[model samples]
Target: MTDLPSRVSINEEGPREGFQIEPGPIPTADKVALVDALSATGLRHIQVASFVSPKLVPGWADAEAVVAGFAPREGVAYTALWFNGAGLDRALAFRDRLSVTGSISLSASEAFSRRNLNRDREGNLAAMRKQTAAHLAAGVPVRRLGIMAAFGCNFSGEVTPAQVFTAIEDGLSIAAEAGVALTRLSLADTMGWANPVAVERLVGAVRARWPALELTLHLHDTRGMAVANALAALRMGVASFDATVGGLGGCPFAAHKGAPGNIASEELAMLCEEMGIETGIDLDALIEAGHRAERIVGHPLPSALLRGGSLRAMRARMAA
Candidate 1:
């Protein structure tokens, strides 16, 4: 309540997150359309595609095609996710279209590293070191540090603040070795095991250790706690977040099938607007994009705002 940020950044991850796990082969055009629609809704950042192995994530086999198709909005920054050098190369081809910066992505839970990334903690660190070098060699800056499974993991159980600290320390070491000064740090609740208190403790501890790193939260709604966890972080002055439009994504590798994905972008924006925190978003337009996402996927998404509608709009109607 006391330390809310004046402006919140909502990075929409629906196109990449949702498209990855859906059972059907969503058309490439539909994927591009969603990115374009989100861009028009005043979202400054949009994750358009994942450049991972098509064999591993067939949904993005047409990643190149989707990147080629979308109309890049001048003001919106489009980003893509790629785990290794090959994926990074694919993204480099669209460097003109996508924001091609890199991140030091690691997992707090060793078990989750093995499950999600198919590597142990040591292997993940080695990979990050190699990946960081690759990004620099390619002339792409590596500044953001991301820790996955920061709260708890379904495979390994409760994750304490200590485990998160170790992960962050490891990431910082990688960046330092590369001579890169990281400006941002992202703590992700990859498995949806985060609660509000855990968010506070972890965020507080991380900030205490590295006060210069700007913090971001990448939360999932696995247990319906993404919004609450986000609120907890916001109250502590953490502003940036990664969310999927209409709750459209789930981790295919986390073994949490049929689980809800990241927090809904429209819902998060509404919450921020209601709290007098500026999100720089058109909530109604974003809600309509959520509906469009449902139509593209041919199924209902988990966003309650998509169904219930925005109260702000209803108030205007009542006043009329």
Candidate 2:
């Protein structure tokens, strides 16, 4: 067994990434109910929704209502994704309810950025900086920022680590200029392109550069390397992870061409517990949520939770 860290923080992305790729719209009341259930499970952070234009992502059209309906829990942190200044503006209205506000999209690879954000990597970075600046000027407490597809782009093939580092540097510089202290920043392998070696090396390099920044991991399971890659990150002391219930995820545009969803929250949670890392989440509750999500999508989710039972059950079955 690996010598796991004592604490692991799991950020539930079911409401945001989980619902992003479904064929039709999910009712706002359902979304609220899901968030409420997640809060009851004692998750510290739950992604409620994004504030993108309704034309782009119709699923998150009721972002404001979702936030308004949220009843503040003593320990849970509510978060929302934003695209640009306008999204931040929407998030600002619910300042009291929001614990963390973040902005993210594909990096400026012409092909990926064009389809995802309609901008190049540099242009999107500028927009992110501007929006972050505006939020800072308004005295908004923006905590975490995520850079999507930081490792490799589905449309661009392979992205250089230098490009990823440059983007982070740009964001950090912008944060300094805007005077917003970014609590955490993540490098997301949106298409599941990173291998263990690559994750290790890249994490090493990033840590050497910015040791103080909280590093978050957002890896996909497309190539079946999600667990292995996560192990690499954990070995390097990456404690925070982004996961969806039942491994449900898809970029609204990318799914049409076949981009798989994210790693399963239950799988990761089970792994963490087995490794002696505390995620503060009940594995049974998480698996039950995954099952519920599969039913809602009317399809089998890619999560191992749906295919395999708990680790102990699997072991017992083998013995039987």
Candidate 3:
């Protein structure tokens, strides 16, 4: 077994993935405010927005404005998701003004590929290769290739390890053919269908296959096992994770309506601190960000840390 990483990194996706599914339109200014608040929490990486269709995902219609609004910090890395050529074009336009990295995302499940992206598995793969090449050619610093529905798909059910493996291999092969090296890969449990066993098995398999690749798990709390699955992956030496503040994210095309969202960033930070893992996040500040997110979303969020205080805070109160 490889040695476990002493410090785990978290990518904050609350502004992009978390807000994409909101029913009501969040003002562009509010979105920027939320991201700025999160930036103050010492989060090094944040997915600020996606360059998708505004008509389709009205919540993120202000992707460009949001990017323009946020103050770029020297240490923090900001990224935007791009699915196709047009999204890539949009991201490239702001490349000079904003220090933005690009993420090329694709799905592993055939049904999900068709449902979410209106393409089959092969078509999605082709698009991914093309988009990746474009980003590479543009000198956009394509940092991550995100594989959604890696564990299990809501439409197809039980996505096999072989399917996930093939997707990763194909992505790598495509990048290698273009002479571009991919450093990070993200496995997303799009519908929260993964358990601890599945997390361990798949994470271990990927680690074995690509020993040098950095792996990040994007898990949902649909079955309340997101944290448990994270623990399992950590045991397998996978250290990075994608988390949303206030746990406010769900796929619009997912089979389950009102499904639970990504693991809350504050909750995950609290868990890591308790486990002696260094996340480099201020838990109190993260909780405050969650509260701000709740106000922006105009609803009670699904974060444990937001609902109940952190363990440290509780212990201090008890001791006093």
Candidate 4:
């Protein structure tokens, strides 16, 4: 608890994560609205869309449109997800509006990679090597390493810290070979298999290995422990996280049938603010954004805070 960071950085993933998993098509305008609402909430980072093939992810076929649609808010860094050179090219078109940096992303679970990307661990590495080179060729600085399924995997079961370390090492090797120095690493609990103890152990282990690297957690709340796990990481001084508004995302390919999505952005924001950690986020505004997300998706989201609401307004009323 004493090691809690003075400020926490939350990367909003609602627009991309929520829409992409839904069965129905969401209007581009609604997606843009969520982005616009979230931006005004003092959130500094948002993952706006994924630039994959329409055949693969039809939800993001309108990625370019969404990118073109949003009114850019100053001081907020916008990001998008892409897997190959084509996706990279599409993202490059919006270089002026988006923070188009590259990441050397790997998966700790071999089974997850095979199913998720149709590539085995060795094959995935080879692809990453090519992707890293491509990114550098495009002048996109490849400075971040992301390890997906770092906590555990449904297909593989129980991803140990050693597997995660190996994934990080592979990513680092790719970066080094490309002459790209990585300053940040994001550990993803892609399927919501992380626990509080596991978060602490892995964070401590990673810090021991790469003490200088900034860490970010991408946690899923499928098993209902996302906030506790976040608190554990906070105690270990991890200040950056990837969250979705109203808990509006689930892994479509991770066999997460009816499971909850990523940790709710508003919940994480409320947690940090309640703990006296500055998140630079307007919790009420964020909650509004969550509500907007629910309206767009046309369903109740997984966020309890959204249903219960924050206590800030209640406190204000009591004071009055």
Q: Estimate the TM-score of every prediction.
A: 0.97, 0.88, 0.93, 0.98
Q: Which should have the higher TM-score, number 2 or number 3? A: 3
Q: Using lDDT, rank the candidates from best to worst.
A: 4, 1, 3, 2
Candidate 2 lDDT over 14-78, as tens digits, reads: 88886666865777777787778777766788888888898877877888888888677888888
**lDDT tens digits by residue: candidate 3, 1-320:** 35556788988999887778888788988999998998998999888998898877788788999999998776888888766678878877778545556566777788888877788867876877777677677877766778889988878889988989878877777777777778999999988889999998898888888888889999989878888888888778788999999887865544567666898888888878988889888888889899998899898888877989888778888999
Candidate 3 — which residues are off by over 4 angstroms?
1-4, 251-257, 316-320
**Which residue runs of candidate 4 sit more than 4 Å off their true CA positions?**
253-256
Model 3 C-alpha lDDT versus the unseen true structure: 0.83
Ranking of all candidate structures by their TM-score, best first: 4, 1, 3, 2
lDDT of 4 at 310: 87
Highest lDDT model number: 4
List model 1 lDDT by residue over 1-320, tens digit each: 77999999999999999999898699888998898899999999999999999998999999999999999988899999998889999999998999999999988999988887789988998999999999999999998999998999889899999999999999999999999999999999988889999999999999999999999999998778889999999999999999999999865534556667999999899999999999999999999999999999998998888999998899889999
Alpha-carbon deviation at 16 in model 3, angstroms: 0.8
Residue 257 of model 2 has an lDDT of 44
Cα deviation at 188, candidate 4, in Å, is 0.6
List per-prediction Cα lDDT, in the order shown. Answer: 0.92, 0.76, 0.83, 0.93
The C-alpha stretches of model 2 lying farther than 4 A from their native spots are 1-3, 100-111, 251-259, 312-320
Mark the regions of model 1 whose C-alpha exceeds 4 Å error after superposition: 251-257
